[model samples]
Target: MMSDVLKNCHHRWKTLNQRWSLQTRLLYINMLLVGLMALGISVAYYTLTRYDKKQQSRERLNIAFKIMQDDFQERL
Candidate 1:
């Protein structure tokens, strides 16, 4: 009787182990996806910020050039 009980217990343990391993794999896959998403978002944010700064710099440079042109014309 004891041997039969031990066999049943062993079988149950094997089933539980398989389920645990599957769950662990799924968790790892989910973590990887989340990491990728975070990286993509970070890159996009940086690009947008850089573009905005470039636009502002261009506007400032144009204004400065216009001022210089006007000043030179007045002197002439």
Candidate 2:
């Protein structure tokens, strides 16, 4: 099964090589690499932003709790 898939891939690659110039193949390869890198960077950025937002929310909640506690003590 694996060999069949490999054969198929080799055939496709051969066909592409025959149809496209070397420069065109290189251009496509570079574009694919750049696109993958961009996707990775964007995902990392999104994850970091989400973590930062959660941290900020947790800090805000703690501050609010502290204020309520102080106010209650004053009333007593």
Candidate 3:
């Protein structure tokens, strides 16, 4: 079943290749590559920003906890 689907896809791709001009095909391929690269960069940036924010949040919590502890120690 999978093989049949793959063969159908291959047939369609060959038909499309034959129908499109060389310049058109190259333009499409270049656009696809650029789009993929842009998507990768965007995802990486988002991941790093999220990680940095999480680290900052954790640091803030630790600072607050230390302040509370210091106050308790002084009172005791």
Q: How accurate is candidate 3 locally (lDDT)?
A: 0.99
Residues 5-66 of candidate 2: C-alpha lDDT, one tens digit per residue: 99999999999789999899899999999999999999999999999999999999999999
Tell me, what's the RMSD of every candidate? 10.5, 2.4, 2.7
Specify the poorest-scoring 10-residue window by lDDT in model 1.
16-25
Residue pairs that clash (backbone atoms under 3 angstroms), model 2:
none
> What's the TM for model 2?
0.80
lDDT of 1 at 72: 100
Candidate 3 per-residue lDDT over residues 5-74, each given as its tens digit:
9999999999998999999989999999999999999999999999999999999999999999999999
Which ten residues in a row are the worst by lDDT in model 3? 16-25
Regions of candidate 2 where Cα sits further than 4 Å from its true position: 1-12
User: What TM-score would you give candidate 3 relative to the actual structure?
Assistant: 0.80
